[model samples]
Target: MTQDTSTRTHCPYCALQCAMHLQPGDDGTLTARPADFPTNRGGLCRKGWTSAEVLTVPDRLTRPLMRKDRNADLVEVDWDTALDHIAERLLTLRAESGPDTVSVFGSGGLTNEKSYTLGKFARLALGTSQIDYNGRFCMSSAAAGSVKAFGLDRGMPFPLTDVGTSEVVLLAGANPAETMPPMMGHLSAPTLIVIDPRRSATAQAALAGGGMHLAPRPGTDLALALGLLHAAHIGGHTDHDYVAARTTDFDRAWEHAAAWWPEHTEQVTGVPATQIRAAADLLGRAAAHRSAYILTGRGTEQHSKGTDTVSAWINLALALGLPGRQGSGYGCITGQGNGQGGREHGQKADQLPGYRKIDDPAARAHVAGVWGVDPDTLPGPGRSAFELLDALGDGGGPRAMLLFGSNPAVSAPDADHVRARIASLDFLVAADFVLSETAAMADVVLPTTQWAEESGTMTNLEGRILRRNRATAPPEGVRTDLEILSALATRLGQPAQRFPTDPDTVLAELGRASSGGAADYSGATPQRLDDGEALYWPVRAGSAPTPRLFLDSFAHPDGRARFQAVEHRPPAEDTDPDYPLLATTGRLMGHYQSGAQTRRVDELTAAEPDAYVEVHPDTAARAGLAHGQWARLTSRRGHTRARVRLTPTARLDTVFVPFHYAGEQAANNLTNPALDPTSRMPEFKVAAVRLEPDPAP
Candidate 1:
């Protein structure tokens, strides 16, 4: 065999983003070896180790394929023809049905530069108001609350390293050990508290470390958050000085939160009064000089009350004087690689490039100047993800959809409903390396390069923008997502004049969009990121790109923070005899989201090949269940059959399922579509379900 000299790049399996050295063997085989990096410490997850094999999958789309009819097979087309048709159809859709009649969906998995470039196309060339991404179902809710309270959405506030000096860390929503292992090393603290509906790996670790784990009823996390903060207030834990100096409307916030005093919260949240007090006491018992961190993940974000629930967490953090401090505060743990970047770059329906609202006149002017377009030419903000799709099936809806790596059919809330909406569209195009569950239903499939074959930048959860290098060339025909999008925009006749042709140029443009805008990044060039220099957002001359945000003042107009004063709302789905159990979905250690790419790999597949519904041993016993037995998990939205395994992690009446499976086992199939009003995130974590024995597979 001959030695291979493939370029080295970062793994696409998880947000850990471990760098990899890919060597293509003489027989056209790709081999991946981990690069010694600070983040992964030269360690690779099962999924990362075998990610290279996904490139050689026999079923990979080798060329652009256009389907002439719903019942027809895909016909291969060259790049020019394929791109032209895609652009033409999109323009036609917009001209006839209006920009809102078509929607653009991006994925968090794309490289930061690709992510940035795609948004540029969507907003400029397309002129579509119905633009959103899969993140609306993952981490937006936590973001909404953090932004409202702390002026930024930081996963750990400072960085993963900041958690190293902490004494007690409250693990809300996130399960790092199983989902993001690199986070575990940094968050290894003396006391780790976990609050989730299911006993996830993080929750279990918290319990094992002799810390408290609060398993509230589904959709009642907001209620529990209120209870805990109210307890803090009742126990004289309110930060009166900070509140008075840096915030307004405290009186109103306190009034609303006071209603959730211990007794009332106990009834609504199902968390015991004593437990709530005990948890607060542990926090209160911490040394005044020591660090305490409150971090939330999807568990808190994917609900109708997601914003309110996260607001409750923020209220607790502010009440405890955590925000704007070194040792304590609330932070949102984002799940996507560019979850922070994707939204910041005008991809969100209502957002511009720098966390500014498109509807805001000043923000519009700044961005329009950067993009060389008129601010008044842009349409007003569009519908969020959940609202966008529901309207697709309505009378006056988008006739076309262009999905970029987002598999809403499997990953979106109410997958069954989303699939129908996709089917309803007259023209659907999917640009992805793999034929995802959603892409399988598309009218056209455009093969695009993956992370390993794309050279760009990615902004991590901490807002650190780093360079991502291409380690290997894509298959002969596959093109970068940005390249395809650009060509298609040109083909559609809405030529994006002056659009940057390379990722570096795109970043430069993105930085320009940030100048004089909220979360400015005018000086954040790709060369700086490539040189191991990451300038956090709000970059300006002599500013040093604020490493720690809100240290001096909040971003609000009055230079102060505002409390959400949120209250609890019941989970849309409730337990009943017909649906007597609760189902919670999440990621596992060996795999990334949906497992579209991960499960295809040999090593990762060997670790966890199929899905299982985890039930409490007691609940399983009563239901006459045994481990590894098939169980039918039914919910109000829908149900799927999976093997049942008894695990102590789940509380009684609640079962757990991993969302990695495609086909019938995708857990999002049963998730509720109801959304948080402010953030537009759906309830993906919890819903009512019932379990019954299945005869056989």
Candidate 2:
């Protein structure tokens, strides 16, 4: 395509979803230029710049592959052959083991239309309730906390521009410098307070600019938040009028906070009372002027007590009277490209389109009507992502599985066990652009179109929906996910008309399905998106896009946010004698979620050649480990070996590992599988592990 014919799209990697222009070169290569989008004003991360390289990667899947039997090798097959084989096996499995024996797993990376269609296909075609997505591991805790406190969930209710307007920005467990480098440009707040265990890139950047960094112990975010709130309450920093006017359960929440004074919290969190008080003072001053924001990310929300930890932060926001203000409130720094819209448009275990509860009678009838199905025939919520994976080989669990986009074998916590579970499945189908670790063992793998080769809508971290125009055509033999879903649904006896291959047609259905629910998107038509306008959800007809929310009230019936009385709880697997160091996992600057697509990019691979453990100098010396020395990290679940990188960034009692690599360096192999009571999130951020010097060559 010529320069003038370039298509405007967004990055396919992170939730920042920075806008960019793509021109397909005659030589089959693609060029990307930063678009002056509001979220990222004409800026792109390294990942975004190199995103096009993935489009023409030498190993990009161009044809479907299927294995004839358990011990057989995967061989290339035609689309029809692959679909028919998968359909026949699914039908046979359903007949032999019942509908509940078929499960579908999805990803947050999918476009809004694709996610909606996947959820519908699993429920209507397979008649199974065991459907969930990899997003459950990403930001479900924040979603759960938002719903509980505000009766709804949107990553950032206000626009990203508000970050620069806020007087004080308190970022909890988020390191945007490495995760979303473009976002740091918006960090113009006078006082920035970052809470994290490690001296992360974001923390260091903030520190360099005179911002404060509170290095709390790993898994102690809840206690840290409680401590901050308690200090604020004691210092009379809380807005009593705002609390009384716009919230409930204040007394109980205050009582919970009172129990954890700064001293007690210091014991639990390892953040000093003086630092807590200073943070409280800054937040209080900002709150007095109605200019503060409390934002969270996976670092604080990927724990067994993730939901409660998020709730504690929400309580602090509510106490400060942040919500309902113009530019101040609690928000989640969503990690996936479409994570906000993915969960809202369905694909979550307990949700329907429009962010409605699946078990709710109104939601059931509304969505069922949109699908032309009987409401009574619809199933209730099923097991969460990890639970479903754990049950794959069980007698009563699903026997056949269909996976889309997600690479759980590399991404899931306790991944070694998850891989074994995948191996035990009677049949498996994977639809992806590359042969991810999860796809390698699948009974069938279907080649699918990449983001730039397709047209769809993706809701970014700000809850803004933007159109992704097709910049180029996919290689022959590969098909869009919509086409694959349509063909597979038809082969499984569903009417072809019900599952159209066009993304616009699917989005139309999605809008209708989401019409009146909490995250209503009825106003977001393909025509509107095609017009190059950005729109946030709760998009009702005849109304303007909601760039900001809760100006007057929340989504709750009482028109007020709720104050959750959350208490501090230790992580499921705490550091002890055998496993004396707290091990936390996170993403690196060069890799996205699982390294499935990013690892294939030569530039990214060159930047982050391999995974390594970040060890505190004290801890490294104690273990007789030197920098670049290979070490073995052993946890209760499993162990992995990686080279040790000594740094003072890590706490003396903590070690950090990047979770991008697989095999012997897989970080998830040592993570805990304990679930958060409310969010069902795995404790990926913290686990107990011991570092041992690897054998010398």
Candidate 3:
């Protein structure tokens, strides 16, 4: 493809942000080809190659829609009518109740400019403190843990290229093989130690590569982490000099892990004691050579004690002197396309631009100055994502909401209850490229431009700011999200200049707003990004981008990392005789979150048409379940049915299900909503379940 015919952009799916070229054909067709980039190295996953198909799906929404009443069907309408009605309803709700009665919900897939604007509009136009995004459910536990340990949170402190030079890589609850096939190229040279409940493809790859795989029981990763630390201490692998010089509270943290001996941890986690010791030895040896990395994913950080679980692993990393080293550090494998940037901007309930605490007077003043508003005019921190959703339409809760780019109906835990709460809202407005499950329930739905149709910037997993160039024009009836937000702000009596539709102008304003904060993007201009500059943030104006962090000192005031005193705990709900099995949820190779876009693609749907329960053969036999037969998995929250697929790779006491399907097949239907106190992340990794066979007709 010639440069004139192809537009350089990143994939629209996961955080890897694999670079690709969108080439337009003579017949008005678009195709995706892998482009050379550091993260993916000229390789594309199946999802990335087929992503263009979603742009032309049959059900793609091309017109604004509105419903006269809750019981009525949504009818096509003009953009002016839809925006005018939505703005009027929002004003009425705010005037009748209060500004706090209106809320805004955002998504992780939004571009940096859009995420920044959504947060600003929620505070300035709607004058509401209730704003959060789906990203709170993605990696909040890891973000919280990282902040507690290092005083800052970036998904990866170093570039992805560092992984190739590591002697050993321990994946705690992460599976790159299926979720991000392109990332597997980096792991081929490392001694892979995979820790997961299921023998995922990553674990299989680890064993086949002469590495190790530790299959712990569901929600028992904290114990396993503590065991590794204890073994490291007893094995004379603790880096005493590094701990004394660069860290604080080490003694207190070590006290928490001292009691978790290998034997005891093995008993709790269902892994062999010998294997636990061996894994510890490998990590310690590799770290001593300064050639090891520890990375975590959703499996270990989706429990009621998720923050502590992540802290336990961080403690182990610190004991081995991992973080802040050249090739050795602890990081989180962020899942969403812009998950790192989505939370860093202002979408989170408790944050302002640049990952600044909204409650901080200085942060508020700085951002308010950029918006030309008084600092006190901005509301204080509001409820988190789940809390915000749970309180909808209740007394003293938000009555009206504006949602963008998210579908919580099929993705949220205790989904039936979330849907009920959504239904109870007095008014709801959704902006999307298609009629998603959540959008289907909205009083007004605004058709918006999607990935290739919009030009913007996204911060990838490595914190690098990359530009997404518009490859083709959007349908005439649809508008960009920025235009939708800008029009609503104008209708709310705000000047057009206050909320710009041009991405370049918004990004410049965002730079000013984020100038002095932790995730500073002051130097990431549209011109610089489009000029092919690889800018990673905390980029102050007139300064170079920061690629790696914490070489000589941590972000804390004392220039030292702090160790969190974390201990192991049982899951929110333990198994009983009535519910003797544990059910866990995860992603499939063919689909993305909530299955909104990928499900619309014929190839993706054909590869995985429906969700299925992965059960161990022994467990299946005990439950009288046979392969290909329908099984009803019931939990305290609700039940979902799926065809059984018996495999020896599954843990004997645990069952696994992909969480991409909707309605009866949704894995989230059986998940618990018990939340972590610190991060407020729900227990999506484990739920007590009972299985019964129901043969399909």
Candidate 4:
């Protein structure tokens, strides 16, 4: 039944970025159905199945706009006028308040082509060092933690499919069933090690399928990780050969773990001592197999202690001499589609393209040469997301901002503060398919093309580079992200000449920057992606990118993984007398972050149109709340009211909310702003709150 419609491609909903073929109906409807591929295997999630509808939504933007005054409504404007407005404002701002007062905010959703070019434009043209992106809240901690321990921070050093062969899988802080369900074929056992404060859908699926659920207290994953590593020491599981030959300061790391044995870590993590020891033994035994993968996810990354938790996870794997082998290594299951590639391209505040730190002289030289700019002129290591936003105004913050493909108003940690900062901006422009919550606050909104109308590439969680081919022509007035960047850059008189009017040229620039770097993509040219099968990263010239990582040598300086000495820290907010319950938030299978695109889809909207708190019956009873009834959830940070749904899925004292809804029901509105000092990510997973009946009204 297969036809010759292989010319089209689509993006997988998760970070795996599995490139797929789109065979439009004979009548020309561009709906995407799964096609068999090596990585995806014809398996797609609910989100991916409906992704095709996103491009055809009725509210999609289709023209440029500008507003003359703060209270004035947006007026239709030509592309020239819009670009000119942006350029003139930038020039005026730079002259009046200096370069530091203006900055840009990029997104992980942007194509690798768009992402890398934006990094270059910011440093070379704007000459502002305050640029940052939304990824700082998501990818920074995982990246920093993995690099500190194993010297690499993409998802896995090994391909995810290798998880099936392992004896035991540590499902710590990750919910693949909901996050990336298609990959579950990698797990052969139901009794994989599941760790989370909340027995989420992933844990529940594992339990129903006969898996082990190790429920730890919120914000204390580091403790359980410490306990397991300590058990590795006591159980004689430590790889002394790998430690001494391939690692540094073995004695110091062991001593650090010994100081907080399983018993002590039990206190911090709320897991019994016996359970901790048993889990460690299980991991050690399973690791002996040919392909065991330790996967980390958002549960471990979105907090301030995010890095340390990631390091501990990697340390546990290193103790067994796991990494740099076939399927036995530490990996992170990145959330955003381009979470890996986005960070690699330097959209982050503190890095350059190809996973190099901004301050690194060699990396600076490499990137500057790639961009054809003076290395000295390129600013290095700007503030992270929170700091960049907090720096707006008096202490020299970006006065003007250009946002693309993101809705920060609903998605940011403390949205009110983000709204205020955007309001304070001298000029703001947003380019998206619709008037997203963040875009609603913009001085001008430019209609932009969606995934179906764009052609480029995205790097997945497994480090696979896949094609994103256009399935349909963009709307009459809409344009691609690359086109927008190029046109706007030209208006600024510093056009991205190398990538002008060509996505392939932009990809070439990204490929060139990947040279001589850890995430080499020279072989991942537009040509290789054109081939049928999926290829993993570390792509080199005239050769293959390694399908799975750590087949031989680790990326660490010594070619072996290091056991990090990680201690535990509690979540910033904890339940007390007034806030006597714990609250956790995450995604729903029916909706995505901010719900801007999905909510617009009628079918998706009907499935879950409103927000509700998942409350355990016992907790709901104690709080005078009932299923299908409204209740007020008050947290240390703020409060929100939602309809209650009694569900056994939630832990006794914890209430769960989905972050997809906006307005008063928005979970971020009630979430704490205290960030993981290390990751700068607002702690969306854990907060302290109390619930009560929504007063008689």
Winner by lDDT: 3
What lDDT does candidate 2 reach at residue 677?
Answer: 85
Each model's lDDT: 0.77, 0.90, 0.93, 0.77
RMSD of 2: 1.3
Q: Residue pairs in steric clash, candidate 2?
A: none
Off by over 4 Å in 2: 1-3
Better of 2 and 4 by lDDT: 2
Q: Give the alpha carbon lDDT tens digit for every residue of 1-697 in model 3.
A: 5457788899999999999999998877799999999999999989999999888988889999999988999999998999899989999989999999999999999999999999999999999999999998998999999999999999899999998899999999999999999999999999999999999999999999999999999989999999999999999999999999999999998898999899999999999999999999999999999999999999899998999999999998998999998999999999999999999889999999999999999999999999999999999999999999889885348998899999999999999989988989999999998889999999999999989999998988889998988999998898999999999999999999999999989889989989989999999987788788879898889999988888889999999999999888899998999999999999988999999999999999999998899999889999898998899899999989899999988888999999999998899999998999999999999999999885445
Give the range of the ten consecutive residues with the poorest summed lDDT in model 2. 1-10
What is the C-alpha local distance difference test score of candidate 2? 0.90
Q: Pick out the ten consecutive residues of candidate 1 with the lowest summed lDDT.
A: 281-290
lDDT of 4: 0.77
Candidate 4: tens digits of C-alpha lDDT, residues 85-204 = 888888898899877777888887888888887887777777778777877766777888877776777676666666666776787788877767777766645347788777777887
The C-alpha TM-scores of every prediction are: 0.94, 0.98, 0.99, 0.95
RMSD of each: 2.5, 1.3, 1.1, 2.1
Better of 2 and 4 by TM-score: 2
lDDT of each residue in 62-175, candidate 2, tens digit only: 999999998999999888899999999999999998888999999999999999999999889888899999999998999999989998889899898988888889999999
